[model samples]
Target chain A: MIENEFYSQQNVGPYEYYQVGEFELEEGGVIPQLQLAYRTYGTLNEQKTNAILVPTWFSGTSKNYESYIGPGRALDENEYFIIVVNQIGNGVSTSPHNSGSPIAMEAFPHIRIGDDVRAQYVLVTEKFGITELALVVGGSMGAQQTYEWAVRYPDMVKRAAPIAGTAKNTVHDFLFTQTLIDAITSDPGFKGGRYTSHTEVADGLGRHADIWAVMGLSTEFYQQELWRLFGVESVEQFTQGFLRPLFQSLDPNSLLTMAWKWQRGDVSRHTDGDLAAALNRITAKVFVMPIDEDMFFPVRDCAREQALIPNSELKVIESRLGHFGLFGAEDSYFEQVDCYLRELLASP
Target chain B: MIENEFYSQQNVGPYEYYQVGEFELEEGGVIPQLQLAYRTYGTLNEQKTNAILVPTWFSGTSKNYESYIGPGRALDENEYFIIVVNQIGNGVSTSPHNSGSPIAMEAFPHIRIGDDVRAQYVLVTEKFGITELALVVGGSMGAQQTYEWAVRYPDMVKRAAPIAGTAKNTVHDFLFTQTLIDAITSDPGFKGGRYTSHTEVADGLGRHADIWAVMGLSTEFYQQELWRLFGVESVEQFTQGFLRPLFQSLDPNSLLTMAWKWQRGDVSRHTDGDLAAALNRITAKVFVMPIDEDMFFPVRDCAREQALIPNSELKVIESRLGHFGLFGAEDSYFEQVDCYLRELLASP
Candidate 1:
């Protein structure tokens, strides 16, 4: 076991798990014993029409979405049942660090966005007896899964909002993800992913964080010295104090697994590389939201995909924080996100 | 000795040297017995008024700028004395890999853009008895030096063109440069800058190349599949065949030395960090050219500084190649660059 405290169940907060035995993947492999770690807010209505699915983003857990679910928030736990599911390989779930034996660590099977959606489908239907979802919403890689859900099971999701992500990953993003993978694997301390502790690859993790410092935030964010908003005095302090510790706490193998899947995210594979055909199957009302300054999934890239999907509108969110604006770096971020979600849910 | 053949004198072609013993750097260090490697085309006129100075960019030697100099071209070497100087730490000159002991390899002294400009000034004034330069032009780091020369020796340079570079390095660019530094240093094969051969750090060099694949070229280049022009069918081949070999051939320590200087490139240090005051010192007729899609030094950043120069015009070059367009990847790239140079050189 990697023995990383950050991923331990105790540290990840309270969450329930449903064992999914012998889960076969889209890429020709089996995760012998699979589990979907998740959390639920509020009670299911008698009609079960108010149940919403909220998938976690890259490196995020069910706990990460807790702020969005509250008594009077857009999710509104008092009115709707919100199910926040942890995407596979995100430490809190059945990830490389936690899985034992042949599947543990670097030996973990490759996971696709479709695989995560399919697994969540089983849990949503078989475990809770929920046949339909009021809405399906997520950001970044989680948004990737949201698109997979809309394309794969359109009838089940009444509305979909994919934020700061695209239906198909761009070649540019694929190359960027490769750099992230290279940053981790190049470290000798990685030991071919057999390292017993996360600290062994601290230098690599710091480098990874340094890359994010460049691309994760917008150029304007750095130009305006937005790190001051985080109460950091210098750029070094922001990188070392904020970004480094955040990444170093995670397992390198788990991060690599997510990066691989993130690079290969293409819902069009469901329709033999025909993106228009795959998206046409989606009957759910869709709002394709991309951050204005997001370098990863630029607004133009998202708007192009939005045009292919029927009944879809391009919603451009203003954020100097760029792709990382999904973290609600500014109070305005949540305000805009909540306003959009409320409108999506209220539609016929 | 690293024994990297890519940077050997034989491989870099014939070049002349000017020795300036015990050269002091702007950043509190001395490079003992400093020799500047350079090449000159055409003969100096009796009055020495037709002399043009061209400086090399990061990882570039005097040979890299040959394409821009020829008969009937903008440079018109037959009619002008063109002095192409290899910037320090560019392997051909007094660099980390070639400079033995004392202040060699990892112990090499820090170099500033001002240091390179000062050394080139000495060579032009003392070695050639050239008191005036008709024009000074360069791209990327070469552009940085062009700005430094115009600002530092405003009286000597009559015309200047800085293409695809900034006068002051942005915080965003500083962070991006850090990622490049981290990519090389993170590899265990780096051995704390004591690796005997370049191959020892092949993994790190590959990672460094991977980062370039993401940022060196514009996103439009990838989206439009422009790699096909290079005769490569896939992104992997473009990265592995073209980019990897290009960077892996250089000395890691030399690249590191250049990167550190590149990150801290600021002419404003001459005027206590007042960019406007520094740029106002330029008496030359200046043309500031920025590629349309350059991710590293965006047009807006360049435009802001161009406004600070009293007699400068912003010339936006169209290139799907982005920052690397300075390499003249497309025939049209040379056409626009030549046109601009001709116009600038013809100016009073």
Candidate 2:
């Protein structure tokens, strides 16, 4: 991987693009042909055995994930060929944030974890002649799809690592996701989602960040750090000072779509509503890493998943960073992940 | 205890002529003097030694709770005087369901658990001429007020039983209550809650019962009862068949008013946001009877209250009736409650 300079627009490599077929979105019962945008790293050996799949997180770009590459990291570019795919709702892909006149009300296809996996499957086979992956790794919503890939195409993914994700979407996750949706859609300027007004953008984004920060930590942490982070002690102050400003940079419509996709990431939709069976079908080796203190998705949820998956291990990372702990806050997390990959994911 | 004939009422009770005063709704800031409309059994005693305060549930009136009273029950009229008080939001107690005009928006006073305690205090003092209550018993929302009474006006309630009630609301409870509020406020007929049309009444109520039943039970119960109750085997069937019709019977405005009161019934509000202090303020002996299988208001919520109240006993009742089970689903609950009151309630 390139250096941190890659994230700086000055030295970034131009993104190589490959378009997969379109998918039909939700509402009005239509499976429209939706498009996919993606990028890849590393090399295929003579045996074509070094393919690792990594998907992007919620509102996260393929660039944001590039930092974990290079000579010695988890997805070391020199050791394994890593394929990072953009999810449908992110701006670089087919999303409400960057798409044309169909911004909000446009009948964007109702995509799912299944849809995402299938789209990546097309790209993997058509572009690289890869029928199987060494492993699939991702965090948050991206991790959701990774977990789904193991369930949907178990034989194709020899091993999988899903960080801070769930087997079945709980109601609390749905509530938190809904809050972000309301923040965007409730603005009078939203105009039934076909909104172009920047006025609502700030309000929508503000609510998004506030929920993320609040949900990502314990009540004790939120109480202690909210003031220091935003220079405001009260919820109102933190909401305005840090939250509103952070989200204001984002488009409201895009926020809603990303949230919509995140909440609907349950793989049970394909298994005729049997969550256990959907998980039971996962034949790929899995290392379930969940944050201990995450109020949203905790290690308890990981154990529930472990119960159904045939070949699975659980790693509980104790950290106050909550969901963020899965990213970089906890050193043991990264270490634990590396150890698991060495023993379970890195094949003979 | 006019035999079982009382329950099979042609129109419930002599509800029409029964008048105490105006309800003086706590919300909408209405200060109109209200009367207590009630029915009694047994005797008030020359010294009023047998006076038992029975607060109505969310929508229940004097008639519904009166069914639990009579000659041979735990709250036997032969042994104690029983007075069923209409809670403020119930139509019988001067609510939006029966008020001549709306309570006037933000001008409405916020009602807390403390406020309900005060309102009941006024009814007992100004109307009943009773200085002391042998015991106060209620279920669900009424139990909320009962808890307030034990603490807020300790001297007034000698013994109290708060069944299936929580001290402070949980996130799950807040979400459940918020959904009901959204259903009413979102109705186009709501028109900012200015009473635009009664057309929304049925739809709002239907959505309300749906929200209630969904949050009230575990996933296990919903699956079993779907077909027997709704004639179809899924959530959609149970909702359309049972929930919709039950909700249709409710008035939208009354639903809103009651929900607002319930959310505000935070014990923290009463004790300057000190939960433990609020619980400690109770001088009246309390029996914290929580149901084992109540999916929403679990027994753990009362754990704090138990630790706080010096004169409290936690009688854990094992039952599958969920929150409602604490209201005496079987003879076991009735016996437990009756024993607690006869032995402990009659203490100094």
Best by DockQ: 1
DockQ of each two-chain model: 0.78, 0.08
**lDDT per residue (tens digit) for residues B1-348 in model 2:** 001121122534544223444444434454454444566767778897778887776655676665476676778988888877766645555455354433433223444555556766776777668889888888777778888787777777788888777667654454346656765565445666555344444554554554455445433344234234324566556556755665565556656766777766666666788988888888888888776656556677666577788888887766544654533445665776677666666577
Which portions of model 1 miss their true places by more than 4 Å? A8-11
**Residue A234, model 1: Cα distance from true site in angstroms:** 1.8
Q: How far off is each candidate at the interface, as Cα RMSD in Å?
A: 1.0, 7.2
Cα deviation of A124, candidate 1, in Å:
1.2
Best by TM-score: 1
Candidate 2 residue-wise lDDT, A19-74, digit = tens: 66444443333333355666677788777778988888775667756655667776
